[model samples]
Target: MELLSLDKLAARMTPGSLIAIPADYSGVSMAATRALVASGVRGLRIICVPTSGIQADVLIGAGCLAELETSAVTLGELGLAPRFTAAAKAGSLTIRDTTCPAVHAALQASEKGIPFIPLRGLIGTDILRQRADWKLAENPFADGADPIVYLPAIKPDVALFHATKADRDGNVWIGRRRELATMAHAAVRSLVTVEEIVDVSLLADETLAAGVLPGLYVEAVAEAPRGAWPLGLQDLYPTDDAELARYAEAARTEAGFRAWLDRFLDGRSAAA
Candidate 1:
C-alpha cells in the first residue's frame, strides 16, 4: 500500500497516456487534476467513463488533453461544459466519439481480459459509422444472419478518481458506483484521492466490505478533502454552483477562459 501526495500521484502519469476518469456525478479527483495542471502536465488522452463536466473542462482549458473519448460533456443543470464545447468546435483535440454503452462495454472487455466485447445496439447509426475501429460480425450461434458490433477493449494506462473514504491499507469505499471497480480492473494502475483515511480495514466489516475496492488493485492513495469541488460527491457535498456558473460564463471565449485559468492557478498557488 502506498500513500502519496496529490502531486506525487499525478507525477506517476506519463504524457500522452490514456487516462480514465469516473462520470461527472461520481467522485472525481479534482485535487489531483489541479495538481496535474500545476505540474504543467500535458498531452493526456482523457477517457471519461461515459460523460464528464468540470473535470474534463478544466483539463481541456489547461491544454492538458491531446484527445478525449466520451459520449458527452455537460455540467448537468449548470449547462454545457464550456471549455470542452469550445475545444470540440475549434477542432483543437482528437475526439473518439462513442455511445454510453459502447464505452462501458469497452471497459468491461478490458476488465474481463478480452480483446473485444460485442454490443447489441449502435447499428445503422452515425455513432457506428464514425468508429472504424468497431467491427461488424455475424453471430456464430445463429444462422449467420444476425449482425453484432464488437468494441475494442479500453485498457487505460491509469484510472484516477476520488472516494468518500480510504483505509490505512489503501482500500477505498466507493459504495454502489461499481464502474470505478471496473475501471481499476481495466487500467494498468489506479490512483485515488479520498476525503479521509480510516484506521480500520474497510473489508473487516461485512456491510462495508461489499462496497470496498480492494487495495490490491490500487497503486496510490492521497487525502483530498472536498476534492470533488465544483462537482458533487455522493452523500457528502453538493456541487459548487456559484463557481461552476462563473466557469461556464468565463469559458465562453478563449480570452475569458484564459483569464479564468489565471485566476484559478493563482488561487491554487496561494492555497498551496
Candidate 2:
C-alpha cells in the first residue's frame, strides 16, 4: 500500500511471471532486479520491449530467465551482451526474436485491450519466419495487394522499471519516454523504483502532469537511489560506462560471470 523496500517489492512478483521491462536506453529497475536475483527468483519470462542490455544479460547470467522476447540485446559501446549471447548460442534460452515495431505493436494491442494488432512490413523477413506465433494475411482494407503482420497482444503479469521520481501517492514521472507508460498500461501490475519519493503531487504542475503515470496504474513503488545503476536515467545521471565495460568483459564466460556476480552481490549486500 505504501512505498516498499526493494526486496519487498521484488517479492511481490511470483516466479515464472511474464515480466515486461523497459528498453535498453530507457530506465530499468536494476536495483530491484538485483534483489530478485539475490532472493533466487527464477523461471521468469522476460519481455524486453524493443531491445535490452545489462538487465536481460544479468538475469540470463543469474539463471533467472526461462524465455526472452526482444528484438536485440547488446551493450552498445561495450560490445555484445555476453550472457544473452552465450545462452542463445548454446540453445539454452527460448527466444522470440521479433522486430522492434512488432514488440511495440504487441504492447499497444494489450494497451488497447485487443487480441491482436496489425502492422506494416516484415513480409519476407526472417523475423516473420522465426515467429510462428505471428500470422500474415492480406490486408482487408487493401486492393488485394497489401499484406500485414498480426502480432498477438503481450499482456505481462508485471511491468518493472525505474523512474526519476514518484509522488507519495505512487504516481511516477517517466518524462518523454512513454514506452514505460505503455508497459504499465499493458501489464496486470506495475512496480517501480524511484530515485526520489516526493510529498507533493506531480500532476499539480501541467508540464509534469503530461509525463506522470497516475498511481492508478502503479501497484507499488520503492525509493531506491541510483535505482537504474549502470544504465542512464535521463536528466538524472549518465550510464556508468566503466562499470558496463567491466560487466561486458566479466560476463564473457561462466567462470568469469560467477566471479563478477559474487562481487556484485557482495557489493549490493554491503550497500543494503
Candidate 3:
C-alpha cells in the first residue's frame, strides 16, 4: 500500500472529480468539501436527511457544487440547486432515497464493482418512479414487499475525513457515529485527515477500536487541527455554531465569499 503525506493528498485531487460527502447534518467533512471545491471539480452530491448535518447547507454556502437532496422533494423540485434556487432552476436533479440504508445500497453496488444491485421496499413508491436516477426492482431474498431502488456506486477520486487518531500507515480509528468507513469502502480511492497519528502498537487494542478504516485502502493522510467543525469530534469537541455563522454570512453574498476567500480561505490560511 502506498502512503502519502498531506501534501500528496492535496496534490492528487483535481477539479474534474465527482464526489460523495457525508449525508448527515453533523460532523460535516469541511476539509474534504473545501479541497474538492478548491480544485474546480465539476459537482458534488451531498446526502441530507430532513434537518441533520446540513452538509448541503455548508457546501451550498461555499458556492462550490450542485446539491443532491434525498428528502421528500424530487430533483426537479430542487431544480439542481446546490445552495441556490437559481442553480436548481438551471436543472439540478434530486432523488427521494430518504434513508441511509437505501443510499448505502446504491454505493454498495459500485463498491462491489457491479453495474447495479437489486433491492426491495421501494417499489411503486414516489422515489422509485419519479427519480430517474434510481432503478428499482424486487429483492431476490424477499418474497413480497416493496421493491428496492438501485442506488449508484460512488467512485470518488479522493476521500478526505477527520479522524481522532490514525497511524502513519493509515489505519484509522473513527469513533462515534461514522459514515467515513462506509464511504471509504465504496470510493475508488481515499484520504484521511487526522487529529493525530498514534503509535502502530495502539491500533491493535480492541477498546481503542470501535471501527477501523484500514490503511491499505487509503492513499494519503493529512494532519489537521480543528478540522471538523459545525461537525463535532467524536467525543472531544463540539460543533462551532459561531464559526458556522461566520461561514454563512460570508457565503450569503458573492462579494462576501470572495472577500472572505482572499482574507482567509485562498492562501496560507486555506492550507492550514
Candidate 4:
C-alpha cells in the first residue's frame, strides 16, 4: 500500500465518484472527511452501508454530493442532520431510500461478484416499491406463492474509513467491525486513515490477524492522529457531543451552516 498525506489521500477521490461510508459508531474518518471538504471535490455519490450521521451531513452541507443511497441519516442525540434534511426537503439531492438489510445484501452480492442477491424482507414496504432496481420474484424453492426481493449489487468506487491502527505491512486492525471489511471487499479501492502505524506486522499475530483487513484490500493509508475526532474511535476517545450539538444548532439555517462551515474549514472550531 502507498503511504500518503491526508490531503493527497483525499485527492485520490475524483468528482462524481461513488463512495461507501460506514455508520457513526464504526471507525469514521472525520479528519479525512474534513480534508475532502477542504479539497472542494464535488458531485460525490455516497452510499452509507446502512446509516450515517455527521460525516455524510458535512459532505452534503458542503454541496459535495449529488446523490445518496442509505437507510437513514440522523445525528443521534443531537437531532436531525440539518443540512441533509434541508436538501431533501428542497429536492436538491437524489435519494435512494433503502432498508438496512437490503444495503448489506447488496454489498455482500458485490463482494461475491454476483449480479444480485435475494432478500426476504421489504415485501410490503414502500422502500421496495420505490426502488426501481429491486425486483420481485417468486421463490422457486418455496411450495406456494412466496415472493422475494432481488437487490442488484452495489459496487462502490471507493470505500473510506478510519481505523485504530495499521502495521507497516499496511494491514488495518478494525477489531470487531467486520462491516468495514465487507466494504473494502465490495469496493474497487479502499482508503484508510489511522491513528498510528506500528513497525510490527499485524497479520503475524494469530489473535490480531482475525480482526485485520489484509493489505491486499487497502490501496493507501495515511497516519492521522485522532482521525476519528468528534465522532469517537472505540477505546481511544469519546464522541464530542458538545461539538455535535453546536453543529446541529448552527446548521438549522443556511447562513448558519455556511458560518459553521467556515469555522470548520479554518480549523477554528472545537478540537481544532
Candidate 5:
C-alpha cells in the first residue's frame, strides 16, 4: 500500500463514488472528510454502515453528496444533525432510509459475493415498503407463508476510516471494531488515516493480529495524527464535546455553517 499525503489521499476519491463509512462511535476520518470538502468533490454517494453524524452532515452541508443511505444521522446528545435535517426537508439530497440490520446484511452479501441477502427484521417495517430495490419473497423452505426482505448487495467503491496505528506492513489496528474490517472486506478498496506508523509487523503478533485489518484490502494510507478529531479514536482520546456543541449550534443556519466551515478550512483549531 502506498503512503500518501492527506490531500493526495482525498484526491483519489473521485466524484460519484460510492463510499462506505462507519458510525460515529467507530473510527471516523474527519480529517479526510475536511480534505474532501476542501477539494470540492461532488456527487458522492455515502453508505453509512448503519448510522452517521457530523461527517455525513458536513458533506451534505457542503453539497458534496448526491445520495445517502443510512438508518439515521443524529449528533447524539446534541440532537439532530442540522444540515442533514435541512437537506432532507428541502429535498436537496436523495435519502435511502435503511435499518442497521439491513445495511449489515447488504454488506455481508457483498462480502460473500452474493446478489442479495434476506432479512427478517424489516419484514413488517415501513423501511421495507419505502425501499423499491428491496424485494419481498416468500420462504420456499417454510411450511407456511413466511415473508422476508431481500436487501441487494452494497459493494461500495471505497471504505474510509481512521485508526490508532498501522505497522510497517500496513496492517491497521482496529481493536475489537470488526465492523470496520467488514466494511473494508465489502468495499472494492479502502483508504485509511492513522495516528502513527510503527516499524513492527502487526500481523506477527498473535494478539495484535486478531484486531488487525490486513493490508490486502487497503489501497492507501496517510499519517494524520488526531485524524478523528472532534470525533475520537477508541481509547486514544475523548470526543471533543465542546466542539460538537459548537458545530451543532453553528450548523443550524446557512451563514453560521459557512463561517464555521471557513474556520475549519483555515486550520483554526476548535475550542475544546
Candidate 6:
C-alpha cells in the first residue's frame, strides 16, 4: 500500500464527517481539531477519555461548534458543568451516551457491512440505562431472557491519529494503545500525524507493532512534533486544573467568555 502525505490527508478530511479521536491529549491533535473547526465544518464524535473531555469543554465553551456529548456525561447533565454533578438539568447539549467501546463496535459493524452487531458484555449496566438511544428488543434467535445489544454500523467518514513515530510512507508506531487500529478498520478513511517521519525499519523496537494501524489504513500522515502538548506525551501532560478553572469562570458569562476565548482558546493556553 502507498503511504500518504499531510496535504492529501487535510484535503480529504472536511467538516460534517464523524470521527473517533484518540483519548490521548496531544497538543497537535487539538491544533488539528481547531483547524477543522476553523474550516467551518461541524459534527464530531470524540472517543471519550479524561483529556478529550476537557478539550471538548474548551472547544464548546469557545462557541467554535457543537457536539453530542457521549462520554461520561449524561443528557440531563448537560447544564451540570464537567467539574460538577452527575445529571444535567434539561439540555445544554444532546448527550449520545455510548461509551468508547461503542466506538469500536460501531466501526466494526460498519466495516463488516452489517446493519448491527450484538456486543458481548456491555449489557445491564448504567451505560444501558443512561443511553436513551440504545434500542431494546427481544433476541430474535435466542430463547433465554438475556437481551442483546444491536449496535449499528459506526464507520467514521474520516479519522485523525497522532502517533509516537511514523515513516515517510505514513506507516506509524502509535505506542501500545490499540484504538488507532480499531478506528482504521472501521473507518473508510484515516489520517495520522506523527512526531517524525522516518524509515519503516526503525520501527523494530516497538513491542506493540502487531497493534500498529498499517500503512494501508492511513490515508495521510504528517511529521508533527510536540503535537500532543496541551493534551500530552504519553505519561506527560497531566491535567492542568488552573486552565480548567479559568475556563469555567470565563464561560460563566457570555461577554467574559468571548474575551477569554479570544485571548486563550484562540489557540493559546491561559498562561500563553
Clashing pairs in 4: none
Off by more than 4 A, model 1: 266-272
lDDT of 2 by residue, 1-272 (tens): 36899889988887789999988678898888888889898888999987899899989999998999998999988889999999989999898888888888899999999999999999899989988899997788887688788889999999999999999888899999899999999999899999999989999999999999999888899988988887889988998787777788878989988887887775542123
- Model 1 clashing residue pairs (backbone): none
Worst 10 residues of 1 by lDDT: 263-272
Estimate, for each residue in 194-216, the C-alpha lDDT of model 6 and write its tens digit.
76677754346566466456777
Quote the lDDT for 168 in model 2: 81
- The C-alpha local distance difference test score for the whole of candidate 1 amounts to 0.88
Model 6: how far residue 59 lies from native, Å: 3.3
- Tens digits of per-residue lDDT, candidate 1, 211-259, equal 9999988999999898887677999999878877888888888888777
**Candidate 6's error at 230, in angstroms?**
1.4
**Model 6 misplacement above 4 A:** 1-11, 24-28, 43-51, 62-66, 73-93, 111-113, 120-133, 139-143, 202-208, 235-245, 263-267
What's the CA RMSD for each of the models? 2.1, 2.0, 5.3, 1.2, 1.1, 4.9
lDDT of 3 by residue, 1-272 (tens): 34455455655655344455553332445555556456555455554422233345444545555445455221222223224443445454332345556666666776788877666576667656676777766566676765556766555555556677778667877665456776677777777777777767435878765577777677777766666654677676886655445545554556665654554444233224
Q: Which ten residues in a row have the lowest lDDT in candidate 2?
A: 263-272
TM-score, one value per model: 0.95, 0.96, 0.73, 0.97, 0.98, 0.73
On TM-score, the candidate that comes out on top is 5
lDDT of model 1, residue 139: 80
Report every candidate's CA lDDT.
Answer: 0.88, 0.88, 0.56, 0.92, 0.92, 0.57
Local lDDT at 85 for model 1: 84
